[model samples]
Target chain A: MDYKINVEGQTARIKLGGRLTFSHHREYRDVLNQLMSHKAQIYEFDLSGVDFIDSAGLGMLLIAKQHAEASSAEVVLKKPAEEVQRMLKVAKFEKMFNIIQ
Target chain B: MGVLANDVQLEKNQGLDSIKVKGLHNNIFVNRESVEKSESDIKNSYILVVDDLEMNRKVLGKHLTKAGFDNIEFAENGEIALQKVAESNFDILLLDIMMPGIDGFEVCQRLRSQSCYKSLPILVQTALDGDDDRSQAFAAGATDVISKPINGPELIARLHIHLENKFLVNRLTQYHDRLADELEVVQQLQQDLVPNEEQIAAIQKNLSLRLSAHFQPSSEVGGDLWAAHELSDGRLSVFLCDLTGHGVVAAVNAFRLHVLIDTLEEYILDPGCFLTELNKRLVALLPVGTFATAFHAIIDPRTEKITYAAAATHTVQIMSAENMQINILEGDGVPLGILANETYETIQIPFPYGSSLLCYSDALVEVSDSQNRNISNQTVKEWFHEAKLKKVDVVEYILNALTSCGITWLADDLTIVSVSNETE
Candidate 1:
């Protein structure tokens, strides 16, 4: 998996591509570090390019959200693929993040 | 001069000059004795001398020969040295710095980069005595250094030390690899001991109960085990056990339990007796600081009742199909292998047609949430209640819920066994 980060004003947008599973742990941690370093008020993870995600990947997303919230920042998930959207809905992630179509 | 003339004639005519022949014989005998005396010291250790100057090579060769090292090869530059190293295994390398094309340091670094040569000793020999040069050689992976006009005693001492250490490391590596391969075979044997799909199906068919189970080990092998047997009185005896630890030790314990239960087929109908006997055996067999939590139950289709005993702290949930009511059977006694005289109590519950019983290891309730804290048992109970209302497979529903809640890998071994009386 790979990620590209863009920051504008107080918002940081991280675009993720490829499979988001346990194998991408290091890359995900690096993205999280980048997000924390920016201290952005709003963080958006664009998951349209994500083709697959396992339970570990979902757990990591939750960790990222928790970290952002602890820093008084808001996190939103945007443009998830169809399968990713179904899994998020099944896991009831809407209770945690502001998911956008 | 007659002897010299006679020696030439001897070579042509196969005739001998006695005095000259005796001298030749003495020389051959002396040479053989010397070679035999040094053979053990050398042991055919191949040493490479990398020097651009032929004179330096000859000097080192003579010193090594005097030290009983007969097997030596020469490489004029670092490039040639690397090529020679790749071609065959050399016990030690005597490298010279300041050579044309690919210096000694670069050769050492490149050799170190390859895993095969990672442990090969490269002794740097140089005339330059700068601190920077020494540090650079060390940084580039030179094992040891011999400074200018090499000291014969120091060179021999360093070579002996490095060669011994290298051989020791190689032997250790071989032992480690062999041990790993053996462990893999043990792991496979343990995994094969678990009930396969065909065995589960046969048990389900014989017992007239819908059975579903999920077993996931935290490692290659785990302590979690579940088994079902058809009792003599036509009841289904099912049990789930979880040992205190994971991996090989736990797997061995699981195997022992499996064999023990299979041997105690007569006690299956009485849950209390079965658990008592099992606990007694475990207390005697299990090592200190190790114990097991288990739930054993007998399902009698004719009597429409379930007799069960628990030696764990985890609650067993039963969902009644008649009214969709969930009943939690609280565990009452200490885990097995803890108190030898502790007797377990058997609880009887209505196992009417269409009722389902869920038995699981603590791994189910011990799953961590997003904040890394364990998800409460209350939350798990609520999910079970919801699953019961939905009329879903209780085991599948609980495992799926846990997975959806971000529990991909369990910290402990997980074993969930669900038995439902579907006969209407």
Candidate 2:
């Protein structure tokens, strides 16, 4: 997926596109590591353009949230696709993160 | 020398001086193409080409060489391809779906089922163009399918895809094997913590001891553990316990049990109190669905005394010297994980010198024949009676007896610890 990082109002947003699967683990971890340098008050993830999200992608997301929480930052999910929304609900992860559907 | 080669020489002369030189250059390029094509037709790789027609094999071999693949092999029918795959590793298989003696689909399935070539990639180059054909290829484990009367570029592309995938899968298997090896090393290290039977014998002064172990893992690692520890008061502590379930998690619990016992030896001296404390700590730390059934006994050979306790384990047997007297040692309490702050009372038995205590995991008593008939315990008792009360090699004797009863596969981890009194 295409990954873009933007900073707005003390929140670091990671914009994603296309499929997120096993191949994206390294890139996803790299993105999280880069965001940690700024000491942002809030970390936002954009899944609006994501066409698919598999088990490995979900694991990456969970690890990213854990790392962000360790640094005293709040993680929020923004503008997820319909499929992404369904997966989050089924896995009961909606209650753990900010899901903007 | 040949006519075609000489015609190219005249083309070099007839053109207007310099203009003819450029045209001759173009003709040379054309001539070079045929020569290069012939060179490619001879390159070598093990390829199994299956086609009903003989001419099809010749044409396909010619084209395959042009694509830089040589060492071509031929099989007219699907059965031959399967036989060849069973014998050797063929790099690429060019299969025709419509063949006699087991069609391409069946051949693919049989090849996959063979012990040797299960991972060999098969490409279906067939005239058949239907979802049914595609599904059949997939069901039979064919890596890819290409349409017949193949476009050269498309054939090359499909070949490349399947070969690359096969290479990746083989590399992955190698990595998995290396990981399994490392895990085995770790498991052995964990197993080494338990003392062998000889070490247990050295600690006991009066009682004759025999320790036998059976570990039949449902997975790579087992959860059961047995240890013989020399306590501070000079008594030997013999412990046999089965942690819940099997595999890595259970093995981890067994390690924890070892550490807990080591720590308990330093602080708690009483067998009853030590086990009770161990039960409380384990229940608090272990995840749900994890618990242990254990029998722990402290034997003092000099005094001909043994203090014993059991937690959800079978009644232990104290065998007399004559092989006629057998006393059962039973303890009333729930298994270790069921209760906290639970007090256990120790039973003191006057174990005479030269007599032996037979303590074991449930595997010994739980053994059954092929038809699920109980044989382990009854056979052990009978074997002891027939052996003439001789002190055979302790560990070997127990293992030999267990094996003779047709009890080779212990369902759970099996361990027996025997201590002989040498003080008298």
Candidate 3:
């Protein structure tokens, strides 16, 4: 998977692409680490470019949540494709993080 | 001989102290001891020198023997060379092209024809003959060719290179064979975890249901697991779980689930509670970012309901006899081992007679057709209709349909289950 991170003051924006499965954990961790080190108050993950998310990929999001919350930051998932949105809904992501669009 | 020892030491100096050779058939790994075993490796090599003249054989054999090769054989002609090679396990062949009757080129061709000598290094001796002879020697499967009035050092160097490669390949083949044997044993154990045909037959008979399933693990063992048990309440509870990885690790996780299921019987009656407790246990069992997606359901004839709870599994498909329209049961919850306190929600639907529920792993949907079109709910309903009309097992029917549509490969384990209440 490919991702671009942009930090602007209090908010950090991430544009992730391709498949976000366990195979992409290294790249995903890099992105998380890069953004988390900024200590932004909010983190927005734009997943419109992501096509698939396996069970392990979903766990990665939880890990991301834990990392962000540890630093008192909020995470928002934005514009996920229909299938990703459906999967997140099925996994009860609403209880854990805020999803938009 | 000392020059041959430097060959392995040089390769070691390149920072590859231990070679990790994988994908030499079934992801086998072999590490060659290039550093310490270099001296013994040269001494243990078997060399065959074939020449029409005894003078040439003696000279070549003496050169090889001086260069730490103690095991040497002689062949006066190509025919004897072929015979000796067939009888003995020669590591390398030193051949003379000037030999009469089945020359070195023909010997190379004949030996190359057999699978056993496929990798044997054939070093052909030429008279600095034209490019045609050298190319012909290569075309006939000569590994390397040396010039006549052979340089002793050059012959030893060529022999050392080929022998090193041959030994590495030998180690790889040995490791691959052992891995295949071990994987076969584990694969059988994995199959044992799945409910056998006799157990399934009895369960279907007891429920008066037509049940069918299709399970195919990938080349390596995967984490897909499933079981059906007759509960004490006279209800049939079925559960399927897929761990996140493949190979031996996934197989171990499947075994762990089997152990947990065998001990946790009380929660099996209630899908939600069962999954909640399973999640709690798995959270402690699995490592971070490693989790299992699961779907558990119980068929209750008394209440005429099929209640199920799921953890990030594919949407369960249900079709009734009335309209044959596919009903989608949304499977929603965090996967097991992700959170310690996550609780699955139990969803109940009518389990009238002649109704069938189709449950499958994500591979079914993830597998796109030739047009790259994903399987949708409508497409599934159509497939279900065709299977019902043809009176074929839905699991097999859909898999066949997918195969005919050019989906001949699966990257992950696949599982499909069809359970019908046929008590009408």
lDDT of each: 0.75, 0.66, 0.80
**True lDDT of residue B334, candidate 2:** 54
**Winner by lDDT:** 3
* Per-residue lDDT over B310-389 for candidate 2, one digit per residue giving the tens place of the 0 to 100 score: 77555366767544566555644556764566666677887666666776665565556556666544455555444425
**Residue B233 CA displacement from its true place in model 1, Å:** 7.4
True contacts kept of each: 0.00, 0.00, 0.62
Worst 10 residues of 1 chain B by lDDT: B5-14
All candidates: DockQ: 0.01, 0.03, 0.59
Residue lDDT tens for model 3, B1-424 = 1243322212333365464322212222335464245436657988888998988888888888887788998999989999999899888898898878988889998988999888888888999578988889889998877788888887776777666666766766787999999999988888888888888888877766677777777666778898888875557888988888566777788889889987778888789999999999999998766788899999876666898999977657888878777777777778898779888888788988778888887767766789988776567667887998887788889988888889988767777788887752
Local lDDT at B395 for model 2 = 41
Off by over 4 Å in 1: A1-101, B1-45, B62-70, B113-115, B205-207, B232-234, B301-303, B322-325, B382-411
- Candidate 2 residue spans exceeding 4 A from truth: A1-101, B1-118, B122-147, B151-172, B201-218, B232-234, B376-379, B384-390, B393-395, B422-424
Show the colliding residue pairs in model 1: none
Given candidate 2, what's the lDDT at residue B200?
Answer: 50
Consecutive 10-residue window with the lowest summed lDDT within model 3 chain B: B20-29
